[model samples]
Target: MCRRFRELAAHPTVLSRAAAAAVALRAGVWSDAAHRFLRRCAAAGNLHACYFLGMVRFYCLGSRASGVALLARAAAGGHAAALYALAVVRFNGSGGGKADKDPHAGVALCARAAWLGHVPALRELGHCLQDGNGARRDAAAGRHLLLHAAARELAAVSSARRRGRAGEDDDGAAASRFMVEWWALTSAEKPATAAGEGGSCGAGEEDAEELRLCSHARCGRRETRRHEFRRCSVCGSANYCSRACQALDWKRAHRGQCGAARWLAAGNAY
Candidate 1:
């Protein structure tokens, strides 16, 4: 099946717009040829092409209006990523000021994208449901969806590893990258008052060291109960909400700093 797809992909002109966009994407967006292909396909009203080109325009080139128009067009056609991208914009009020934020619309768009099997959308929708940010609070349903999303993420990573493309430019890798970057942005924006000195939630000064956030910077979830999170086997310092978060943290930052001596010196001895 992979060989057949490669054979079909070789004929870019005959490929569907999405396939063509994928080829162009693999060619690297900085390549003039890839850029031209994306532009031409986007001009031809190809939804996937519009999505890629619009993201480049909005994020890389800073062409907000044109990029948003294209993204909106693709989203209107039920492009999952486009819908999710627009949802992020709405949630952040990227179109205007904080007052312009439309969390309800963002939640609605995320729900649509989640229905289409966009993993990030599913995860974001779950968070929204849990917090009642836009939708009515449903902690049980939200937890179920979050667990489902985590399962899908693990499966995606496992599939990528089986294909010998674990770190390649695949959807799973892309989603992980998005999560890392998104968390960085949100962490910077979060108020200092939200977390205690040790990144613990609802902690008094005396119990500050008793509970802590997941050690993964991209997953700053605080432990809801004492000893709820698992500590790293190697260092016994870093905590993680799930195996997926642990893997991501290891890849992103923990690999270099994960040493028993180092953690012990930092007063994380356990």
Candidate 2:
């Protein structure tokens, strides 16, 4: 009865006499009901509501694309969190591909969110600095930000763990992981795996089979107008710097190449 009454008051044509029309959601609410409420409100074109649902989707509760697309739309419509999320979506190619990952726009949106003291945005700014993601890779600046994020995470965790804290949040796992990832990055004695070359070795290497080892034979530049060539295609079945190179390379290795190409082409999913 009260829900319907509040809804009617918030209607556009209604006088909106009530001072409190916005419904308050308590923590005990089940997931299905919350999804239903968000879905209804989002479908009604409520920008803020869509942003909320987008966060739910982004944090693994729903499909990756759906969350990002909705967040991009909401950010375009001026939702603040959505604006921050748009930056992330752009960075990850989730909303679209590299062409749509507008780094300039992402930086602007991130700055706006940072101005509002948004915690996630602060962490993101650190990430941008560390990765040179449309910005300079200033390790010092990134460390400062990761430290700030660590402090905020600790404070929130302390508050949440206090007795009678109402269980309104469960940020412990998220905070711990953030601290670990950030501290590892900030430390001068970083983990060895961070060195790209170190990741390429070992008998059980993850990329062992898929990666084609460069023979470096002749070690010549393989472009047509350059030192000269035999540039292997996807399966090493053909080497063609040009159609002309194709004939030369074919005479040298074509029969074997064709034999392998025939057997391999059928399952080249990678």
Candidate 3:
């Protein structure tokens, strides 16, 4: 199988090269011939090859700078997973370079990855947004993002469990924890009322439960005390009445700034 894969990986077609490289990497076989093939494929502009080669160089060969450069090249070509990997490196100060410790840069990268439909990036961005890490505090928006990510994670866990995949139970447990945390964060908020109705109750009561507007810039629906609106889990900075509205808001603008918010929440500024 290894010999067959090596032969296929050396094929001229880009797809063949990518597939071969992926299989070889996953199989933990890093022969000199495989490495040469990956380098050639990456040089030929195969994004997958670039990513795989980058990972091999960074993790196996201890060439951090070269690996990161390759990853950046892939990310520039719009590879979502590469972007997420870079974000993680930046967030954790890994890779042994000046660029390794830039949380602000990491957050920005994570948000971009999230916009590109990276699931882990979405979850990380949600956490950042809630904590106002690199952006402003917006608890309502943060909570919505977190819940959305958690729901998706739970679904994935369910699928993995059905397949009897190892460690799926742990993933399910984590998803459950996220749900519990979300509930704890939201349980304290009061129900919302209709617009102007709060004013009718008198000026003194207005201070107790302030009226809010929808977080989405395009959908500024006025929230009243009687309305049951969803608030953000981290900072409670915004409110949304429906999942659609929240999703729209996130896609439109929230995703870009969520990382900063999360950084702030974590008591780390950069």
Candidate 4:
């Protein structure tokens, strides 16, 4: 299949080159010929080829500067994986050279990638938010994102188990174990608030204040005639005054807890 794909990749078309690059990546074909094909495809503006070639150059060939440049190019084109890769590099200062470790920039890049639906990016962003490494501390939002990521991993595991694919179960089990550990850690950090401490008026005031404010983090805009909030369709635990706020909240926090209510109703361990 690799040989056949390479032959087909000889064509000058963008799709052919991209397909060949993808196949080569999957087959771990890091030969000179494969590199040449990837370079050609990347030069022709194939984002997948650019990302694969960048990774190969960075990890396999140790061409850090060149690889990072290629990754940056791909990221500028809105490649989520490339953006996540750059975030990792920025966070760790692993590529050598100046070793300019910028945690804030890394977190921002991760947030962008998460917004683009990258799972690893979501996990990284959640960790950053939880620890307040670069962004403001928001334990609730971080937990929400982490749980969502775990749920997504669980969904993947369930699919793999159903398919009976070799090695997938091991991966799923590892993800599940990580999720369990994370949940335990988060649970341990919960504050011990005394029940029945506040009077009825205080509870009522809190509930009214919560109802009047938007659920999106830091927005806190009180609902008014111009800004009528709507409850989330899946969890209904939060409300948003506008679609933009809703989308931001979903990307940053609610995505993890979204549909969780349904999963619980169906007796799933979400």
Candidate 5:
């Protein structure tokens, strides 16, 4: 079976099939063998195999160093998802102490992915620029990029609708999906502030909640005055510093949370 898997992975046309078979094996009883198959494919320079095996090793098996090295190899091969994944790892300082957080390097990786037309990286770079998290603050440029990303997302959705399929393999779908997941991971971190800007609002202070960080994960802007930022139209809990941030946030995180159930709950409480 392992010999057959290696043969299939070696063939360019059947590589995806072999990966799928490996995944199925992992799901059933041959989990260890599946991992070994993936590792072999990755070592053989399969980009997708490298990415999948790297993520599993990093997050599931706790082999952060080797996993990151594999991911870096994939990124160097011009794999857009791999680049974006590495950007996230760097930005969050994963697998290292807080001192390892390299937001600047992360921003550079996002730039490369965005250059390849990755929508999430584009949105992320825009947010970073707006918030000056890893780059110089350029609200105008950031807003423009955000608008561009939103337009691309809408186009992707329209195309998917026309095709009568989810279009999960498209550039837009992967990025949007990743952004939502990334937002979930980083939402709890408070927005940074300059000197003398004071601290984040304490919990349970509903009145002062409006001053909290922008709902957009990459965007760290805080409201300067009462009702300075606008709230989400549906959920009314999320706040955005601008329409661009609002649109991006909707795609990233608010879309899932702004369901009818949430609206009803908030309405009844009010």
Candidate 6:
């Protein structure tokens, strides 16, 4: 390998290169010394190089670019991982400007990413669809997409677990597992509006304020239109009005939703 590759290995944030290095090591692409060379190629910003580099930084190597830029670059270049990463960032408010904090914007971004062939994005897009976020509430399409996302999540989770080793630090695998479980649960949940089916419909234009959102199945009350409820554990319906209202009415209804609701919340049951 050339000296440049070796020098690149020492760079603080050469994630794309590091990813190439790891892949080369794993696939016998070349000797270890050449790994840095691959990283350099990626750092150079070639399209394919950027895509692979973005993936490596995300699924493996860490970097300094706030994670959002990496996803953006990859998504712009049509890399699936970049699209998925971008969705996660947008949803979690970790990147892609402040729009990540807006569910409506997040939904749009997720849909865009999904359309570009990202699994997590696909799943999240399903949620947006079911919830009428920047799109009409399409239950049928939501369910279908969620099912696909669920299956993919499950497979990905299994693959991640398989990659774990006794002495290995498996952050990547663990992340996959988390995604798998989340998507799995989400895939089981119901459509976003199931529980509060009639609550927001002409609940009035201004008087009706949506408020008090909760996750992990805790009970709560509604007050303002903040965010959509996650989902009923038993049913796919999303009941949001108040914690008191949730507990008072949902214990029984959730039983019906339990099978699908969790997954729907994760945006996988789409």
TM-score for all predictions?
0.59, 0.44, 0.51, 0.54, 0.60, 0.41
What are the lDDT figures for the candidates, one per model? 0.65, 0.49, 0.58, 0.60, 0.64, 0.47
* Alpha carbon RMSD to native, model 5: 12.2
Cα lDDT of model 6 by residue, 143-164, tens digit? 7987887687567667767877
Off by over 4 Å in 2: 1-36, 43-48, 55-80, 166-270
Greater-lDDT candidate between 1 and 3: 1
Separately for all candidates shown, the number of backbone clashes (residues 3 or more apart, or on different chains) is 0, 0, 29, 1, 0, 43
Candidate 4 lDDT over residue span 95-136, tens digit each = 442346677898999899889877667877887788787789
Of 3 and 4, the candidate ahead on TM-score is: 4
* Candidate 5 lDDT over residue span 194-243, tens digit each: 24444322222233333455587755334333455567877677877544
After superposition, the stretches of candidate 6 with alpha carbons farther than 4 Å from their true spots are 1-42, 46-66, 95-100, 151-270
Worst 10 contiguous positions by lDDT, candidate 6:
199-208
Per-residue alpha-carbon lDDT of candidate 1 for residues 108-215, written as tens digits (9 for 90 to 100):
998999999877788878877887878999999988988988798788778888888743353323433433443344355346645643321122222434545568
Clashes of 3: 29
RMSD of each: 13.1, 20.3, 20.4, 19.2, 12.2, 15.4
Question: 223, model 3: CA deviation in Å?
Answer: 47
Better of 2 and 3 by lDDT: 3
Report how far residue 22 has shifted in candidate 2, in Å. 9.5
The Cα error of candidate 1 at residue 215, in Å, is 14
Q: For residue 152, what is the lDDT in candidate 6?
A: 74
Instruction: Give the distance in Å from residue 250's predicted Cα in candidate 5 to where it truly belongs.
Output: 5.3
**What's model 3's TM-score?**
0.51
Instruction: Write candidate 3's Cα lDDT for 137-252 as tens digits.
Output: 78888888878877876787678878987433331122223223322322333232333222111111223345454575543223323233566554566676334346656777
Question: In terms of TM-score, which candidate is stronger, 1 or 5?
Answer: 5
Q: Give the candidate number with the greatest lDDT.
A: 1
The TM-score ranking, best first, is 5, 1, 4, 3, 2, 6
Q: How accurate is candidate 6 locally (lDDT)?
A: 0.47
Q: To one decimal, what is the Cα RMSD in angstroms of model 1 from the true structure?
A: 13.1
